[model samples]
Target: MQASLFSGLPDRRERSTAHKYLAFVYCTNKEWARCDAAFDAAFDARPSFALEEYELQNTPWRDAYVKAQGKRGWQCSRPLAGQGSNNRPGQDSANPLVFSLNSTIITAITPLLPAAGGHSMALDGGSPGAFGARRPMRTENNVQLRVSPWANVTLNGKRLGVTPPLTEIKLPPGSHTIDFSNPGFETVRKTLKVEPEQSITITHDFDAR
Candidate 1:
């Protein structure tokens, strides 16, 4: 719905800064063609903006723009001053026009974090009431668990699985107990809060018993 709606926004269509974000939305949807086009438009909007201008750049948009470029075999010029640092990227204040509480509608965009081995981490959830809670859902969110070595996993009291990496599991919103255990290592446990329509990550490294 958002992509379709944004597709009609004059700013997005006319190659405004919005094109940078539209590219992100497209990337999230894995719409490579649209993503590339949106990014290309962004570059055309500011072709001379150099990486050294990182300090003055809109970081999220710039980072996503560069990532898209790299993935597409397009070369990006790195800022000479800070060649190898993982220093934070530039930041931009959210536009008040687009992010006011009084507004009937709003959109929040989260960047995709690519993991090694060609996997990507992304979270997508619909409107608050879209996923009905008629009689109370069995689970309202997905949790991604990462544990060192393989360990037995459990939710509440039921065993779920043993995992070197547990991609995801569903659980009700609010608080829940997670348990992990592996031979020769101390058992690990945690209490977590799960928000509806969001992804939570839990990482545990067991200490040798």
Candidate 2:
């Protein structure tokens, strides 16, 4: 399934995330070379990629990550005044989960969700979210979406326009409402539980009940 998720990912940053995840899996399987290659691919996708502080200090893939960074003659950059922070599980911050586009998915939010405190860049290990300077981060979860046909997406009370292009949204951790509507099909509203560092899939098939 992880391999399948990488098929049509259009964003370079998202691609780096996929590579990093694959690297972790490879290392867990003891596929040393593949693990290193995956990390390298991640770097190629995004040079600014880095492991979170927790990812650097702990986790089974730490050594592999270090080795990968060493090959490039690099070190983790320090977090600017208010730019970096920890995003551990059960926390209110996380890396956005990515969804690759395909024929079946009309509107899917795959690139990731808003950062917890600030806009965060997706990274290899736990996301020590890199806050975005422009927008304020208000959510701690990333939601992956899949809607068939086409639909007008609405989250909370705001209209998210139509699908086929809407790929990112931000929301706080907790329960939120999402509405999917198409011309001939009935509107479907779903309530979801969002958590930090956890990826949730909200799929709606207008053709089905």
Candidate 3:
């Protein structure tokens, strides 16, 4: 699909889009080199691609993007104090130059109805909010799950066939809920609104006490 898109599209903008999409695909596959190549192709066609249009916050591939750009000295300017860094996952909080965010990470309080228990679960975190109230522009609905080594993951209250340490799942775009549970760690539940062709990644860090 990526090769077809790149080969078929010769226009600069279209090619740029293809490269960005390919970067996203490669990121999901954990192929950093191919992802970097895609980013290079994307920026060659559109120099301002990252600064003006690419989304860095809550994106699963930002770490790869940052490392790729760092090799080329494409340092991203930080957004500023209390401006928008809370939501960007891969940015360094102490080093402003490596961090940025276009909007706040939206969190809402909601009750989680248990699948089989009489008790209800209280969920307190949410996905990143719309960018500037106009909805961040997106293309696909990919869900990437970064679970702890021993955590079990469930989507929309349904347990996946796998047990733990899951990576990614592609789903239809819409509202989805995720839960991460382990014996010794606190179960985490979150609600996210997914957009078309947009990849959403949720990482469950089990180190917190």
Candidate 4:
């Protein structure tokens, strides 16, 4: 669809519109590299592309891309207090500070969410069911969970959302038992210890009865 649009444009005006549209589509789809490339190409073709216009159209995307890149140390600036340096009141500088990428990203992006909070949690591993020795970490405030529709989700004792693909939800820090249920499938239960500046993932599969 995108390729078709890109190829269909004939005039400079049409081409410029196509580029902007493609950039927006990429951004909406969370294709950061493609979005940046599209915008870059547009600007290259039309140097007159206004920064304000670009920003208005791409600020959310740019912020997300910058943050995603920052996690991998792609384009991060040094903090005034310095990396892993804590300035807690009366705290000794000798104390070690742990630098958590998940915590930093969440803290940086949460403010961008609507009044309900725009924060979303990410599974560390590509596959949710793949579990390692380390358990998933939950954020202190407004923790978000994304799960597959095939996977059931329940908070406390009450059933929360449906299985397969689950909607994102905001949760406070503490202990929460998530029950995954599927008909003709074995139930999976996970106990999560939630804290601020932490991200965790839990994955399981149910067998058909």
C-alpha lDDT of all candidate models, in order: 0.46, 0.53, 0.49, 0.43
RMSD of 3: 15.9
Task: Give the best candidate by lDDT.
Answer: 2
Residue-wise lDDT of candidate 2 within 117-179, one digit each (tens)?
Answer: 211223224433422122223343255455543356777766654443344554555777888
- Who is ahead in lDDT, 1 or 3? 3
TM-score of 2: 0.36
Candidate 4 TM-score to native: 0.31
Q: Residue by residue across 24-114, what tens digits does model 3's lDDT show? A: 5455444667777888877777676663322554343566666666766667664423433321335354422222322222111111111
Predicted structure 3, TM vs. truth: 0.36
lDDT of 2 at 203: 55
lDDT at residue 18 of model 4 (Cα atoms): 50
Among all windows of ten consecutive residues in candidate 1, which has the lowest summed lDDT?
97-106
| Tens digit of per-residue lDDT, candidate 4, span 34-78 | 767766655545544432322332133444333333444444332
RMSD values for the candidates in order, in angstroms, are 18.2, 16.0, 15.9, 15.6
Per-residue lDDT of model 1, residues 84-134, tens digit only: 221122523442111111211112212223232311223234444222222
lDDT, residue 195, candidate 3: 57
TM-score per prediction, in order, is 0.32, 0.36, 0.36, 0.31
Estimate the lDDT of model 1.
Answer: 0.46
